[model samples]
Target chain A: DTAVSQTPKYLVTQMGNDKSIKCEQNLGHDTMYWYKQDSKKFLKIMFSYNNKELIINETVPNRFSPKSPDKAHLNLHINSLELGDSAVYFCASSQVGKRQYFGPGTRLTVT
Target chain B: TQLLEQSPQFLSIQEGENLTVYCNSSSVFSSLQWYRQEPGEGPVLLVTVVTGGEVKKLKRLTFQFGDARKDSSLHITAAQPGDTGLYLCAGGDSGGGADGLTFGKGTHLIIQP
Candidate 1:
């Protein structure tokens, strides 16, 4: 079984459109995070949620919103997508003071 | 943001060779972690070092945390072709409201047979 899972492995959309990527973890972890990996392969933290509480906003734009309905799910919704947003978005989970486990990643392409 | 800098962004070596990758930072980290990622996948945790001047080994791979807790190194001995991947190092906790682990740009290692 996959410890961490993400929906829509690939996404392609036009600029100004809105999209959402969903993430789920079966590892029973209390913390989940969203990260963006640019073409240069730099993984930047975007948002983090622990037990459905928003933490670690990373100064992300208002257009980028993350919602965690529960400890096991975290979803990222992007409004007015820009071409610069084209990159791989990853979801990761970890227990307190533990190593993170990542999902397969959602590749987003904005035209 | 705490920044982690990784040296030699890219490296290619033949099988049986040994190499070391460095990850440095200005701010001290409560803990440090190393991960390996392949194309079309997310990073896989290799190890985590929490103490200064700590060293941990996994088979032929050895990880070391700097005495200052601001840097780390990964050394692989007798690298095999299967070891080819993007290696990333992250520092600090991924917890606390609005604070996340700072990651290095990553080193792309290519091992050839």
Candidate 2:
């Protein structure tokens, strides 16, 4: 069974277009996170939710919003996307005091 | 800002060779983790070292944590073509927000057969 999964493995859209990427986890973890990996392969934390509660909110722009409707799901919604937003977004889940399990990742391309 | 620096941004070696990569930081961390990422996939956790001066081995890969908890090393013996991938090191509790891990730039390893 897939422990962590993400939707729309690839997304290509024009600048200023709005998009959303969905993520789900079946590992029954309490903590879910969003990370962005740039072309340089530098992974940075964007957001984190623990048991459906907002826990970590990085210095991402207000255009990027993360919503966790429940402990099992966390989704990212981007508004007015720009060319600089092109990157791979990854979703991960982890139990308290444990290692994280990552999803395959969603590649977002902004033209 | 807390940062982890990975040495040898890119490496390409023949099969059966050995290589070592380093992850260094100026600030201390509560824990450190190593991950391997293949093409079109997210990083997969390989190991986690928490204690100072701790060492762990998985098969032919050996991991070591510095006594100050500010650095770590990954040594792979008998490299194989299947081992080619990007290796990443991350540190936890380096003020990267709550429960966030600060990741290094990563080392790209290409094992040639």
Candidate 3:
């Protein structure tokens, strides 16, 4: 069974369009996170949610929004996507004081 | 500036060679983690070191946390093509594992057979 899963493994959209990537974890973890990996292979944290409560917002742009409906699901919605937003987005989950488990990333391309 | 920095942004080595990847930071962390990611995939956790000066080994991979909790290293023994991937080091603050991690620019390794 997949411990962490993400939908839309590849996304290609035009600039100014809106898109959403969904994530689900079956590990029963209480914490979920969204991360953006740029073309330079730098992974940066965007948002974090613990038990459906927002915990960390890492100076991400307002156009990028993360919503966690429950402990097992976290979704990222991007509005007015820009060319600079083209990158791999990853979803991860972890228990308190434990290592994180990541899902297969969603490669987003904005034209 | 990046909170964590990794040395040797890219490395290509012949199989059976040993190599070491380094991760450094000026700020101290409560815990440090190492991950390996392949193309088109997210990072997979390799190990987590919570205490300073702690060292953990997973098969041919050895991970070491700095005595000041500001640096870490991953050493691979007899590296094979299967070990080729992007290696990342992340730091977590005192908020436990629930907080967002500060990641370093990953080291991309290519092992040749």
Candidate 4:
């Protein structure tokens, strides 16, 4: 069974459109995070949630928002997506003192 | 802003060769981790070092944390074709604000058989 899973393995949308990616973890972890990997392959943390509470918000733009309905789910919503928003998004989950487990990742293409 | 800078952005070597990757940062960290990522997949944790000057070994891979906790290194002995992947180093601070990890850009390693 997949420990962490993300919906829509690939997304292609037009600019100025809003889109959402869903992530769920079955490892019963309390912490979840969203990371963005750009064209240059630089991975950066965008947001983090612990027990359904927002814990970390990086320097990401206000257009990017993350919501956690529970300890097992974290979703990312992008508003008015721009061309620069094209990148791979990964969802990960971890316990307080354990290694983080990641999903397959969703490749977002903002055309 | 806290950042981890990795050296040798790309490395290509023949099978059975040895290599080392370095990750450096100006800021001190409470713990450092090494992860390997295959194409189209998220990174998988290989090891974590919490103490300054700590060294850990996994099979043919050896990881070392700097004495000042500002740098780390991963040495792979006798690398094989299956070991080809992107290596990333992440730093975590003890102060409990975000507990979020700062990751390096990563080193892409290619092993040819």
Candidate achieving the largest lDDT: 2
Task: Give model 4's DockQ, 2 decimals.
Answer: 0.63
lDDT score, candidate 1, position A50: 76
- Cα shift from native, residue B45, model 4 (Å): 0.5
True contacts kept of 1: 0.71
Per-residue lDDT of model 1, residues A1-111, tens digit only? 999999999999999999999999999988888999999999999987875567755467899999887778999999999999999999998885566889999999999
Q: Residues B1-107, candidate 2, lDDT per residue (tens digit)?
A: 89999998999999999999999999998899999999999999999999999999999999999999999999999999999999999998743334767899999
TM-score, A chain, model 2: 0.95
How close is chain A of candidate 3 to the true chain A, as a TM-score?
0.95
The digit string of per-residue lDDT tens for model 2 on A15-106 reads 99999999999999888889999999999999888755676555799999889888899999999999999999999988865788999999
User: Against the true chain A, what TM-score does chain A of candidate 1 give?
Assistant: 0.95
Chain A TM-score by candidate, in order:
0.95, 0.95, 0.95, 0.94
* Cα lDDT listed for each candidate: 0.90, 0.93, 0.91, 0.90
Ten-residue stretch with the least lDDT total in model 2 chain B = B92-101
Prediction 2 global C-alpha lDDT: 0.93
* Candidate 4 residue lDDT tens string, A1-111: 899999999999999999999999999888888999998888888888876567655578999999887778999999999999999999998886457788999999999
- Judging by DockQ against the true structure, name the best candidate: 3
**Which pairs of residues clash in candidate 1, taking residues 3 or more apart in a chain or in different chains?**
A56-B97, A56-B98
Writing each residue's lDDT as its tens digit, candidate 3 over A6-56 gives 999999999999999999999998888899999999998888888657765
Ranking by lDDT: 2, 3, 1, 4
